[model samples]
Target: MNATHTTFAQDNGLRNIPAVDDFSGMINHPNPLIRESSPLLGFTVRVKTLLDPPEDKKLIDLIEQDIRHILLRLEAERYEPGILISWSYFFCTFIDEMVMARPWGIECWAQHTLLVRFHSETWGGEKCYQLINRLLLEPSRYHDLLEFIHLCLCLGFQGRYRMTAQYQEERERILRLIHQKLQSVRAQQPAERTALLSNTVIHVGSTERERRYRLHGLLSVKKIAWMMAFIALAGFLLFNWQLHIQTENIIDRLDVLLP
Candidate 1:
Protein backbone atom coordinates (compact mmCIF):
# COMPACT_ATOMS: atom_id res chain seq x y z
CA MET A 1 0.00 0.00 0.00
CA ASN A 2 1.14 3.54 -0.74
CA ALA A 3 1.65 6.20 1.98
CA THR A 4 -1.65 7.90 1.12
CA HIS A 5 -3.51 4.61 1.44
CA THR A 6 -1.92 4.00 4.81
CA THR A 7 -2.94 7.50 6.00
CA PHE A 8 -6.52 6.93 4.80
CA ALA A 9 -6.69 3.57 6.57
CA GLN A 10 -5.53 5.24 9.73
CA ASP A 11 -8.59 7.44 9.60
CA ASN A 12 -10.86 4.38 9.69
CA GLY A 13 -12.84 4.99 6.47
CA LEU A 14 -13.40 8.69 6.96
CA ARG A 15 -13.21 10.96 3.89
CA ASN A 16 -9.74 10.89 2.42
CA ILE A 17 -8.59 14.42 3.23
CA PRO A 18 -5.68 16.03 1.49
CA ALA A 19 -2.44 16.75 3.32
CA VAL A 20 -2.17 20.04 5.21
CA ASP A 21 -0.02 21.65 2.55
CA ASP A 22 -2.62 20.85 -0.08
CA PHE A 23 -5.43 22.09 2.17
CA SER A 24 -3.46 25.24 2.86
CA GLY A 25 -3.24 25.87 -0.85
CA MET A 26 -7.01 25.47 -1.07
CA ILE A 27 -7.55 28.00 1.71
CA ASN A 28 -5.16 30.44 0.11
CA HIS A 29 -6.79 30.17 -3.33
CA PRO A 30 -7.57 33.62 -4.78
CA ASN A 31 -10.87 32.76 -6.38
CA PRO A 32 -13.54 32.59 -3.66
CA LEU A 33 -11.44 34.55 -1.09
CA ILE A 34 -12.46 32.92 2.29
CA ARG A 35 -15.75 34.83 2.64
CA GLU A 36 -15.33 37.76 5.04
CA SER A 37 -19.10 37.87 5.60
CA SER A 38 -18.56 35.70 8.69
CA PRO A 39 -14.84 35.21 9.05
CA LEU A 40 -15.07 33.26 12.34
CA LEU A 41 -17.60 30.83 10.89
CA GLY A 42 -15.57 30.37 7.75
CA PHE A 43 -12.38 29.85 9.70
CA THR A 44 -14.09 27.30 11.94
CA VAL A 45 -15.32 25.39 8.91
CA ARG A 46 -11.81 25.23 7.52
CA VAL A 47 -10.38 24.04 10.84
CA LYS A 48 -12.97 21.31 11.25
CA THR A 49 -12.54 20.13 7.66
CA LEU A 50 -8.77 19.87 7.99
CA LEU A 51 -9.01 18.04 11.32
CA ASP A 52 -11.55 15.47 10.12
CA PRO A 53 -8.78 13.23 8.78
CA PRO A 54 -6.49 11.73 11.42
CA GLU A 55 -3.24 12.31 9.55
CA ASP A 56 -1.70 15.64 10.63
CA LYS A 57 1.49 16.03 8.65
CA LYS A 58 2.40 19.72 8.45
CA LEU A 59 -0.58 20.64 10.62
CA ILE A 60 1.29 23.31 12.52
CA ASP A 61 2.23 25.18 9.37
CA LEU A 62 -1.36 25.24 8.18
CA ILE A 63 -2.63 26.51 11.53
CA GLU A 64 -0.01 29.25 11.54
CA GLN A 65 -1.20 30.37 8.11
CA ASP A 66 -4.81 30.32 9.26
CA ILE A 67 -3.98 32.48 12.26
CA ARG A 68 -2.11 34.96 10.06
CA HIS A 69 -5.08 35.25 7.77
CA ILE A 70 -7.42 35.88 10.68
CA LEU A 71 -5.12 38.53 12.10
CA LEU A 72 -4.95 40.29 8.75
CA ARG A 73 -8.73 40.41 8.58
CA LEU A 74 -8.90 41.75 12.12
CA GLU A 75 -6.44 44.48 11.22
CA ALA A 76 -8.40 45.40 8.14
CA GLU A 77 -11.62 45.52 10.16
CA ARG A 78 -10.01 47.91 12.68
CA TYR A 79 -9.61 45.81 15.86
CA GLU A 80 -13.05 44.52 16.80
CA PRO A 81 -12.41 43.37 20.37
CA GLY A 82 -15.29 40.93 20.35
CA ILE A 83 -14.07 39.25 17.18
CA LEU A 84 -10.57 39.10 18.56
CA ILE A 85 -11.79 37.34 21.68
CA SER A 86 -13.60 34.87 19.49
CA TRP A 87 -10.40 34.31 17.58
CA SER A 88 -8.53 33.70 20.83
CA TYR A 89 -11.04 31.06 21.88
CA PHE A 90 -10.86 29.53 18.43
CA PHE A 91 -7.10 29.13 18.71
CA CYS A 92 -7.54 27.54 22.12
CA THR A 93 -9.60 24.85 20.42
CA PHE A 94 -6.67 24.24 18.11
CA ILE A 95 -4.63 23.37 21.18
CA ASP A 96 -7.11 20.66 22.05
CA GLU A 97 -6.99 19.30 18.49
CA MET A 98 -3.22 19.26 18.57
CA VAL A 99 -3.20 17.43 21.87
CA MET A 100 -5.59 14.81 20.52
CA ALA A 101 -4.00 14.34 17.09
CA ARG A 102 -0.27 14.59 17.82
CA PRO A 103 1.41 15.67 21.03
CA TRP A 104 4.83 16.57 19.66
CA GLY A 105 3.82 19.39 17.33
CA ILE A 106 1.84 21.16 20.04
CA GLU A 107 4.92 22.91 21.35
CA CYS A 108 5.96 24.22 17.95
CA TRP A 109 2.46 25.52 17.20
CA ALA A 110 2.20 27.10 20.65
CA GLN A 111 5.55 28.85 20.37
CA HIS A 112 4.65 30.09 16.90
CA THR A 113 1.31 31.47 18.12
CA LEU A 114 2.99 33.24 21.03
CA LEU A 115 5.66 34.89 18.91
CA VAL A 116 3.36 35.74 16.02
CA ARG A 117 -0.03 36.60 17.50
CA PHE A 118 0.04 36.90 21.29
CA HIS A 119 3.22 38.94 21.27
CA SER A 120 1.96 41.23 18.53
CA GLU A 121 1.36 44.84 19.56
CA THR A 122 -2.07 44.70 17.98
CA TRP A 123 -3.23 41.85 20.22
CA GLY A 124 -4.51 42.94 23.64
CA GLY A 125 -3.04 41.47 26.82
CA GLU A 126 -6.54 40.82 28.15
CA LYS A 127 -7.28 38.51 25.24
CA CYS A 128 -3.95 36.73 25.63
CA TYR A 129 -4.56 36.28 29.34
CA GLN A 130 -7.99 34.81 28.71
CA LEU A 131 -6.63 32.34 26.19
CA ILE A 132 -3.83 31.30 28.55
CA ASN A 133 -6.30 30.65 31.33
CA ARG A 134 -8.31 28.42 29.04
CA LEU A 135 -5.26 26.40 28.11
CA LEU A 136 -4.24 25.99 31.78
CA LEU A 137 -7.64 24.69 32.77
CA GLU A 138 -7.56 21.92 30.18
CA PRO A 139 -5.97 18.85 31.79
CA SER A 140 -4.63 17.33 28.57
CA ARG A 141 -2.97 20.42 27.10
CA TYR A 142 -0.05 20.45 29.53
CA HIS A 143 2.54 20.71 26.78
CA ASP A 144 0.81 23.75 25.35
CA LEU A 145 0.52 25.27 28.82
CA LEU A 146 4.20 24.73 29.55
CA GLU A 147 5.32 26.09 26.20
CA PHE A 148 3.17 29.18 26.63
CA ILE A 149 4.66 29.85 30.03
CA HIS A 150 8.16 29.30 28.65
CA LEU A 151 7.52 31.77 25.83
CA CYS A 152 6.20 34.31 28.30
CA LEU A 153 9.33 33.91 30.40
CA CYS A 154 11.57 34.32 27.39
CA LEU A 155 9.75 37.49 26.34
CA GLY A 156 9.74 38.95 29.83
CA PHE A 157 13.46 38.21 30.26
CA GLN A 158 14.11 40.03 27.00
CA GLY A 159 11.99 42.99 28.17
CA ARG A 160 9.59 42.48 25.26
CA TYR A 161 6.66 41.50 27.49
CA ARG A 162 5.96 42.76 30.98
CA MET A 163 5.61 40.13 33.67
CA THR A 164 2.53 40.96 35.69
CA ALA A 165 1.45 39.60 39.07
CA GLN A 166 -1.08 37.24 37.51
CA TYR A 167 1.51 35.94 35.05
CA GLN A 168 3.94 35.33 37.91
CA GLU A 169 1.32 33.32 39.78
CA GLU A 170 0.61 31.26 36.69
CA ARG A 171 4.32 30.59 36.25
CA GLU A 172 4.65 29.37 39.82
CA ARG A 173 1.64 27.09 39.50
CA ILE A 174 2.94 25.56 36.27
CA LEU A 175 6.35 24.98 37.81
CA ARG A 176 4.81 23.21 40.75
CA LEU A 177 2.92 20.93 38.39
CA ILE A 178 6.11 20.22 36.49
CA HIS A 179 8.02 19.38 39.67
CA GLN A 180 5.26 17.02 40.68
CA LYS A 181 5.28 15.35 37.28
CA LEU A 182 9.05 14.97 37.41
CA GLN A 183 8.86 13.37 40.83
CA SER A 184 6.16 10.99 39.66
CA VAL A 185 8.23 9.99 36.65
CA ARG A 186 11.30 9.46 38.81
CA ALA A 187 9.36 7.28 41.21
CA GLN A 188 7.91 5.17 38.42
CA GLN A 189 10.94 4.65 36.16
CA PRO A 190 14.44 5.36 37.35
CA ALA A 191 15.91 4.84 33.88
CA GLU A 192 13.63 7.49 32.32
CA ARG A 193 14.76 10.09 34.85
CA THR A 194 17.52 11.48 32.67
CA ALA A 195 15.24 12.04 29.71
CA LEU A 196 12.52 13.61 31.84
CA LEU A 197 14.99 15.98 33.43
CA SER A 198 15.83 17.40 30.01
CA ASN A 199 12.26 18.67 29.55
CA THR A 200 11.63 22.43 29.69
CA VAL A 201 9.45 22.03 32.77
CA ILE A 202 12.50 21.04 34.84
CA HIS A 203 14.36 24.22 34.01
CA VAL A 204 13.17 26.20 37.03
CA GLY A 205 14.12 23.46 39.45
CA SER A 206 17.55 23.01 37.87
CA THR A 207 18.19 26.75 38.01
CA GLU A 208 17.32 26.83 41.70
CA ARG A 209 19.71 23.97 42.39
CA GLU A 210 22.50 25.75 40.56
CA ARG A 211 21.87 28.92 42.56
CA ARG A 212 21.97 27.06 45.87
CA TYR A 213 25.17 25.28 44.87
CA ARG A 214 26.84 28.60 44.14
CA LEU A 215 25.67 30.03 47.45
CA HIS A 216 27.01 27.02 49.34
CA GLY A 217 30.36 27.35 47.62
CA LEU A 218 30.57 31.07 48.44
CA LEU A 219 29.84 30.43 52.14
CA SER A 220 32.43 27.67 52.28
CA VAL A 221 35.05 29.96 50.78
CA LYS A 222 34.23 32.70 53.27
CA LYS A 223 34.58 30.30 56.22
CA ILE A 224 37.95 29.07 54.99
CA ALA A 225 39.24 32.63 54.51
CA TRP A 226 38.18 33.61 58.02
CA MET A 227 40.02 30.65 59.50
CA MET A 228 43.19 31.46 57.58
CA ALA A 229 43.04 35.09 58.74
CA PHE A 230 42.63 34.06 62.40
CA ILE A 231 45.59 31.65 62.22
CA ALA A 232 47.88 34.27 60.65
CA LEU A 233 46.99 36.84 63.36
CA ALA A 234 47.75 34.40 66.18
CA GLY A 235 51.10 33.38 64.68
CA PHE A 236 52.14 37.03 64.22
CA LEU A 237 51.32 37.82 67.91
CA LEU A 238 53.23 34.81 69.20
CA PHE A 239 56.32 35.67 67.14
CA ASN A 240 56.31 39.28 68.36
CA TRP A 241 56.09 38.13 72.04
CA GLN A 242 59.01 35.73 71.62
CA LEU A 243 61.21 38.38 70.01
CA HIS A 244 60.45 40.87 72.81
CA ILE A 245 61.41 38.36 75.51
CA GLN A 246 64.80 37.63 73.78
CA THR A 247 65.56 41.43 73.51
CA GLU A 248 64.81 42.01 77.25
CA ASN A 249 67.11 39.12 78.28
CA ILE A 250 70.01 40.53 76.19
CA ILE A 251 69.54 44.04 77.69
CA ASP A 252 69.68 42.62 81.29
CA ARG A 253 72.95 40.79 80.45
CA LEU A 254 74.50 44.04 79.02
CA ASP A 255 73.51 46.02 82.19
CA VAL A 256 75.10 43.39 84.52
CA LEU A 257 78.36 43.32 82.53
CA LEU A 258 78.65 47.17 82.61
CA PRO A 259 78.19 47.26 86.45
Candidate 2:
Protein backbone atom coordinates (compact mmCIF):
# COMPACT_ATOMS: atom_id res chain seq x y z
CA MET A 1 0.00 0.00 0.00
CA ASN A 2 1.12 3.56 -0.73
CA ALA A 3 1.45 6.28 1.93
CA THR A 4 -2.13 7.45 1.51
CA HIS A 5 -3.56 3.94 1.56
CA THR A 6 -1.58 3.10 4.65
CA THR A 7 -2.71 6.26 6.39
CA PHE A 8 -6.35 5.80 5.44
CA ALA A 9 -6.36 2.14 6.43
CA GLN A 10 -4.89 2.87 9.80
CA ASP A 11 -7.43 5.60 10.47
CA ASN A 12 -10.36 3.58 9.12
CA GLY A 13 -13.26 3.40 11.61
CA LEU A 14 -10.81 4.69 14.22
CA ARG A 15 -11.75 8.37 13.99
CA ASN A 16 -15.05 10.26 14.05
CA ILE A 17 -16.34 9.87 10.51
CA PRO A 18 -18.66 12.87 10.40
CA ALA A 19 -16.08 15.26 11.79
CA VAL A 20 -13.31 13.95 9.52
CA ASP A 21 -15.48 13.96 6.38
CA ASP A 22 -16.88 17.40 7.15
CA PHE A 23 -13.39 18.85 7.54
CA SER A 24 -12.26 17.15 4.32
CA GLY A 25 -14.96 18.83 2.23
CA MET A 26 -14.14 22.29 3.51
CA ILE A 27 -10.43 21.95 2.81
CA ASN A 28 -10.96 20.27 -0.58
CA HIS A 29 -13.06 23.08 -2.09
CA PRO A 30 -11.61 24.04 -5.52
CA ASN A 31 -11.61 27.82 -5.27
CA PRO A 32 -8.63 29.10 -3.30
CA LEU A 33 -9.68 32.75 -3.60
CA ILE A 34 -13.02 32.23 -1.82
CA ARG A 35 -13.08 32.64 1.93
CA GLU A 36 -14.49 29.78 3.98
CA SER A 37 -17.98 31.13 4.81
CA SER A 38 -18.04 29.25 8.09
CA PRO A 39 -14.89 29.29 10.21
CA LEU A 40 -16.21 26.37 12.30
CA LEU A 41 -16.97 24.43 9.16
CA GLY A 42 -13.54 25.19 7.78
CA PHE A 43 -11.81 23.84 10.88
CA THR A 44 -13.96 20.71 10.93
CA VAL A 45 -13.34 20.20 7.25
CA ARG A 46 -9.60 20.45 7.65
CA VAL A 47 -9.62 18.04 10.57
CA LYS A 48 -11.85 15.56 8.78
CA THR A 49 -9.70 15.57 5.65
CA LEU A 50 -6.65 14.54 7.64
CA LEU A 51 -8.65 11.94 9.53
CA ASP A 52 -10.25 10.49 6.41
CA PRO A 53 -8.32 10.61 3.15
CA PRO A 54 -9.32 9.10 -0.19
CA GLU A 55 -6.88 6.76 -1.98
CA ASP A 56 -6.18 9.31 -4.70
CA LYS A 57 -2.49 10.34 -4.55
CA LYS A 58 -3.16 13.75 -6.05
CA LEU A 59 -5.90 14.46 -3.56
CA ILE A 60 -3.67 13.44 -0.69
CA ASP A 61 -0.86 15.60 -2.07
CA LEU A 62 -3.18 18.58 -2.37
CA ILE A 63 -4.52 18.09 1.13
CA GLU A 64 -1.03 17.86 2.58
CA GLN A 65 0.17 20.93 0.72
CA ASP A 66 -2.89 22.95 1.66
CA ILE A 67 -2.68 22.05 5.32
CA ARG A 68 0.98 23.00 5.45
CA HIS A 69 0.51 26.21 3.52
CA ILE A 70 -2.44 27.30 5.62
CA LEU A 71 -0.73 26.47 8.90
CA LEU A 72 2.53 28.18 7.92
CA ARG A 73 0.75 31.30 6.68
CA LEU A 74 -1.39 31.45 9.79
CA GLU A 75 1.59 31.02 12.11
CA ALA A 76 4.30 32.96 10.27
CA GLU A 77 3.28 36.28 11.75
CA ARG A 78 3.64 35.04 15.34
CA TYR A 79 7.46 34.82 15.12
CA GLU A 80 8.35 33.18 18.45
CA PRO A 81 12.05 32.47 17.97
CA GLY A 82 12.59 30.52 21.19
CA ILE A 83 9.57 28.28 20.76
CA LEU A 84 10.45 27.76 17.10
CA ILE A 85 13.99 26.64 17.88
CA SER A 86 12.83 24.44 20.76
CA TRP A 87 10.05 22.87 18.69
CA SER A 88 12.40 22.35 15.77
CA TYR A 89 14.90 20.58 17.98
CA PHE A 90 12.34 18.24 19.57
CA PHE A 91 10.70 17.43 16.24
CA CYS A 92 14.01 16.40 14.72
CA THR A 93 15.95 14.58 17.43
CA PHE A 94 13.47 12.61 19.56
CA ILE A 95 11.07 9.80 18.68
CA ASP A 96 7.41 9.91 19.77
CA GLU A 97 7.79 6.72 21.74
CA MET A 98 6.27 7.38 25.18
CA VAL A 99 3.84 10.17 24.27
CA MET A 100 6.09 12.55 26.18
CA ALA A 101 7.87 15.61 24.78
CA ARG A 102 9.70 13.56 22.17
CA PRO A 103 11.23 15.20 19.16
CA TRP A 104 9.31 15.39 15.90
CA GLY A 105 11.48 16.15 12.90
CA ILE A 106 11.04 19.66 11.45
CA GLU A 107 13.37 22.37 10.09
CA CYS A 108 13.90 26.09 10.57
CA TRP A 109 13.85 28.85 7.96
CA ALA A 110 16.65 31.35 8.54
CA GLN A 111 14.64 34.49 7.89
CA HIS A 112 11.60 33.24 9.76
CA THR A 113 13.65 33.63 12.97
CA LEU A 114 10.74 32.20 14.97
CA LEU A 115 11.66 29.02 16.82
CA VAL A 116 8.14 27.74 17.33
CA ARG A 117 4.40 27.96 16.78
CA PHE A 118 2.03 28.41 19.74
CA HIS A 119 -0.87 26.33 18.51
CA SER A 120 -2.08 23.63 20.90
CA GLU A 121 -2.26 21.11 18.09
CA THR A 122 1.31 21.89 17.09
CA TRP A 123 3.31 22.32 20.32
CA GLY A 124 0.72 22.51 23.06
CA GLY A 125 1.53 19.52 25.27
CA GLU A 126 0.51 15.94 24.37
CA LYS A 127 -1.40 16.97 21.25
CA CYS A 128 1.93 17.66 19.59
CA TYR A 129 2.72 13.94 19.82
CA GLN A 130 -0.53 13.05 18.10
CA LEU A 131 0.28 15.50 15.31
CA ILE A 132 3.79 14.10 15.04
CA ASN A 133 2.66 10.49 15.01
CA ARG A 134 0.09 11.24 12.34
CA LEU A 135 2.76 12.87 10.17
CA LEU A 136 5.29 10.06 10.62
CA LEU A 137 2.74 7.42 9.65
CA GLU A 138 2.81 8.98 6.21
CA PRO A 139 5.93 8.48 4.10
CA SER A 140 8.03 11.33 2.58
CA ARG A 141 7.21 13.57 5.54
CA TYR A 142 9.98 12.63 7.96
CA HIS A 143 11.97 15.69 6.92
CA ASP A 144 9.34 17.94 8.47
CA LEU A 145 9.51 15.84 11.62
CA LEU A 146 13.30 16.23 11.67
CA GLU A 147 13.10 19.97 11.39
CA PHE A 148 10.60 20.29 14.22
CA ILE A 149 12.64 18.14 16.57
CA HIS A 150 15.89 20.05 15.92
CA LEU A 151 14.33 23.44 16.52
CA CYS A 152 12.56 22.33 19.68
CA LEU A 153 15.62 20.79 21.28
CA CYS A 154 17.99 23.57 20.26
CA LEU A 155 15.65 26.21 21.59
CA GLY A 156 15.08 24.32 24.86
CA PHE A 157 12.61 26.10 27.22
CA GLN A 158 11.32 29.51 26.08
CA GLY A 159 13.58 32.49 25.23
CA ARG A 160 16.13 30.92 27.56
CA TYR A 161 17.64 28.75 24.85
CA ARG A 162 21.17 28.65 26.15
CA MET A 163 22.12 25.57 28.16
CA THR A 164 22.65 25.87 31.91
CA ALA A 165 25.09 23.65 33.78
CA GLN A 166 22.47 21.03 34.64
CA TYR A 167 21.00 21.00 31.14
CA GLN A 168 24.41 20.85 29.52
CA GLU A 169 25.20 17.82 31.64
CA GLU A 170 22.01 16.13 30.57
CA ARG A 171 22.67 16.87 26.91
CA GLU A 172 26.18 15.50 27.20
CA ARG A 173 24.83 12.32 28.74
CA ILE A 174 22.40 11.90 25.87
CA LEU A 175 25.12 12.58 23.30
CA ARG A 176 27.35 10.05 25.02
CA LEU A 177 24.73 7.40 24.36
CA ILE A 178 24.33 8.54 20.77
CA HIS A 179 28.08 8.28 20.31
CA GLN A 180 28.06 4.78 21.75
CA LYS A 181 25.40 3.75 19.29
CA LEU A 182 27.37 5.31 16.46
CA GLN A 183 30.42 3.33 17.49
CA SER A 184 28.47 0.08 17.44
CA VAL A 185 27.42 0.64 13.85
CA ARG A 186 29.51 -1.17 11.29
CA ALA A 187 31.98 0.92 9.20
CA GLN A 188 31.33 4.12 11.14
CA GLN A 189 34.26 6.54 10.95
CA PRO A 190 36.50 7.32 13.93
CA ALA A 191 36.01 11.00 13.18
CA GLU A 192 32.32 10.73 13.90
CA ARG A 193 32.95 9.63 17.47
CA THR A 194 35.57 12.33 17.92
CA ALA A 195 33.23 14.97 16.64
CA LEU A 196 30.46 13.86 18.98
CA LEU A 197 32.79 13.93 21.97
CA SER A 198 34.11 17.34 20.97
CA ASN A 199 30.63 18.75 20.66
CA THR A 200 29.64 17.38 24.04
CA VAL A 201 32.73 18.88 25.65
CA ILE A 202 32.17 22.22 24.01
CA HIS A 203 28.58 22.38 25.26
CA VAL A 204 29.68 21.54 28.77
CA GLY A 205 32.43 24.13 28.63
CA SER A 206 30.03 26.84 27.58
CA THR A 207 27.84 26.40 30.66
CA GLU A 208 30.57 25.48 33.14
CA ARG A 209 31.80 29.03 33.51
CA GLU A 210 28.59 30.21 35.17
CA ARG A 211 28.36 27.21 37.47
CA ARG A 212 32.00 27.62 38.54
CA TYR A 213 31.63 31.31 39.21
CA ARG A 214 28.60 30.77 41.41
CA LEU A 215 30.32 27.99 43.33
CA HIS A 216 33.41 30.12 43.89
CA GLY A 217 31.33 33.02 45.13
CA LEU A 218 29.55 30.81 47.62
CA LEU A 219 32.84 29.40 48.94
CA SER A 220 34.34 32.87 49.33
CA VAL A 221 31.40 34.07 51.40
CA LYS A 222 31.64 31.01 53.66
CA LYS A 223 35.39 31.47 54.07
CA ILE A 224 35.00 35.12 55.10
CA ALA A 225 32.33 34.37 57.70
CA TRP A 226 34.43 31.58 59.18
CA MET A 227 37.51 33.87 59.44
CA MET A 228 35.55 36.58 61.26
CA ALA A 229 34.10 34.13 63.77
CA PHE A 230 37.56 32.68 64.51
CA ILE A 231 39.06 36.17 65.09
CA ALA A 232 36.26 37.13 67.49
CA LEU A 233 36.72 33.94 69.53
CA ALA A 234 40.52 34.44 69.70
CA GLY A 235 40.16 38.01 70.93
CA PHE A 236 37.68 36.99 73.64
CA LEU A 237 39.97 34.21 74.93
CA LEU A 238 43.07 36.46 74.99
CA PHE A 239 41.27 39.18 76.95
CA ASN A 240 39.91 36.68 79.48
CA TRP A 241 43.38 35.16 80.06
CA GLN A 242 44.99 38.56 80.72
CA LEU A 243 42.24 39.50 83.22
CA HIS A 244 42.65 36.20 85.09
CA ILE A 245 46.41 36.80 85.57
CA GLN A 246 45.79 40.33 86.87
CA THR A 247 43.08 39.12 89.30
CA GLU A 248 45.41 36.41 90.71
CA ASN A 249 48.20 39.00 91.35
CA ILE A 250 45.75 41.31 93.13
CA ILE A 251 44.43 38.45 95.34
CA ASP A 252 47.99 37.41 96.44
CA ARG A 253 48.83 40.97 97.40
CA LEU A 254 45.57 41.45 99.34
CA ASP A 255 46.13 38.14 101.21
CA VAL A 256 49.86 38.94 101.68
CA LEU A 257 50.73 35.45 100.49
CA LEU A 258 53.25 36.77 97.93
CA PRO A 259 55.14 40.13 98.53
- Best by the lDDT measure: 1
Q: Give lDDT: candidate 1, residue 82.
A: 44
- lDDT of candidate 2 over 1-259, digit per residue (tens): 0113223323433234334222233232222211121122232233323423333434323323443443454345353453343343343222111112212112111212112322222233344434444444431323223222322332232212132444555454433333333333311323322222121111112234322211011123457589889999999999999999999999989889655
Q: What shift in Å separates residue 231 of candidate 1 from its native position after superposition?
A: 46
Q: Which residue pairs does candidate 1 place in steric collision?
A: none
Model 2 TM: 0.20
In model 1, the runs with Cα more than 4 Å from the true position are 1-121, 142-145, 154-259
What's the CA error at residue 57 for candidate 2, in Å?
A: 35
Best TM-score goes to which candidate? 1
lDDT of 1 by residue, 1-259 (tens): 1112222112333245332212232232221212221222223233333434335555445545555555565456454454455444434443333233334435535444433444343324454445545544542323323333332222122121233544554554544554444333333443422332232221212234222211011123457589899999999999999999999999999999998
* Candidate 1 residue 195 C-alpha distance from true site, Å: 3.5
For model 1, where is the 10-residue window of minimal lDDT? 210-219
